[model samples]
Target: MSESIRNLLEQVKNGQVSVDTALLKLKTKPIDDLGYAQVDLHRVVRQGVPEVIYGAGKTGEQIVGIISSMKANGQCQILITRLSPDIAVYIQKKYEMTFVESAHIGYIGDIPIQKTKSSIAIITGGTSDYKVAEECAVTAEFYGNKVERVYDVGVAGIHRLLQNLERIMSAKVIVVIAGMEGALASVVGGLVDVPVIAVPTSVGYGTSFGGVAALLSMLNSCASGVTVVNIDNGFGAAYMANMINHIGESK
Candidate 1:
């Protein structure tokens, strides 16, 4: 901070600075326009959260710009979800210490890393659903949550889900991704006491309607704890799960 800014803060501490003055200092926290990128730096200060990079539409350069800006202050862990393999490659080459899984949905880190014995499991109904499940796991890991994945355990093979019952039920939260009829979420919901964030992926054929059937099925889940995100929204599911688990970790 400059001498002027330091004096301003001192006045605020001494009760001489009006609320308006405090507002001005806090207002500078967010949204830095870098022409190509508009960074939301104030999110962490204002909302107790940091901005995330939505990696699907933007070029590798734009993502680099956003994540690099978040890393500038060295406070918040940066996350970029829905990163394609090509972009992941570019990011890996640029940021040497960061992990770039070609199959991963994103990356995570900042300050003292968060970890918990209380785990979050990413569950998927079928092999085709692995990508979304991977995304959920990666994003959760980035947020400092310990994550486990239970893939290819949809209702088609009741035995598979049955095999992992202990792990699934024990988790703090379960993110279930599925396509086809999306019956897995309802089944998992009925069995587990914890929250189930249902993710509908565009993984099935004709009647699946690009996961619409699965999305509706998840929304209509008879199971009480089931919550559904948009079709193919693994990132949204993970983000919500992090928010829910964040409280427990802090306690």
Candidate 2:
């Protein structure tokens, strides 16, 4: 059983909660059907993380309604990825949220306090990859893990990455965000003992095939620890990294 459920049972035993109320809380439906959205209320209980809103295809009103449903179900922190500034403005009228333009993320509620001593490192191949790197950083931090950012360290200038060897080596998990040939993942994977998640962005030229080339390159990485996510999928990379970073630690 989850800690929250155990605490609820304890409250019932202590007479702090009425039996009917406890039953109602326990019997709460895992999915809240909100017509347009079926919000997963039991995700936190099952996965130790809440369901995140993918804001790209959603309108402001739909997003607001989902947020309302989540809030009503006692979910405090919400993460919205690929959110636009305009839609953020519309949602801001209803609830306070921090919108990060670079990462295109909207966050509701306070970032959780760090949960573990080990950290996740977010490394980028170039300045252009900062957008993806920021997305990984924000998602990792929101999940209560410390993040170290190492930007503009692609293989083109091996010295730049070499300079941050300490930070790279110390991380519990590392996320490598890069475009073009996406060779950074292999390089970093070869260097770090920890897991390396590679993200390929659509920032390269025509021959790059809109990040497909990078995606393939990363998929074929020779480094043992290297793993690849979809093109421009920073959130997925961070989510996996968070799980690895939090291994053996309490949620």
**Reference-based TM-score of each model:** 0.82, 0.93
**Relative to the unseen true structure, what is the C-alpha lDDT of residue 155 in candidate 2, on a scale of 0 to 100?**
95
Error of 1 at 26 (Å): 3.8
Q: Give the lowest summed-lDDT range of ten residues in model 1.
A: 96-105
Please give, for residues 49-123, the per-residue lDDT of candidate 2 as tens digits.
789999999999999999999999998889999999999999999999999899999999988774568999899
Model 1 ranges off by over 4 Å: 1-27, 73-76, 97-99, 102-114
Pick the lDDT winner: 2
Q: What is the lDDT of residue 127 in candidate 1?
A: 91
lDDT comparing candidate 1 with the true structure: 0.79
Model 1: per-residue Cα lDDT over 151-176, one tens digit each? 89989889999999998988888899
RMSD of each: 5.2, 1.9
Q: lDDT of each prediction vs. the true structure?
A: 0.79, 0.91
- lDDT of model 1, residue 10: 84
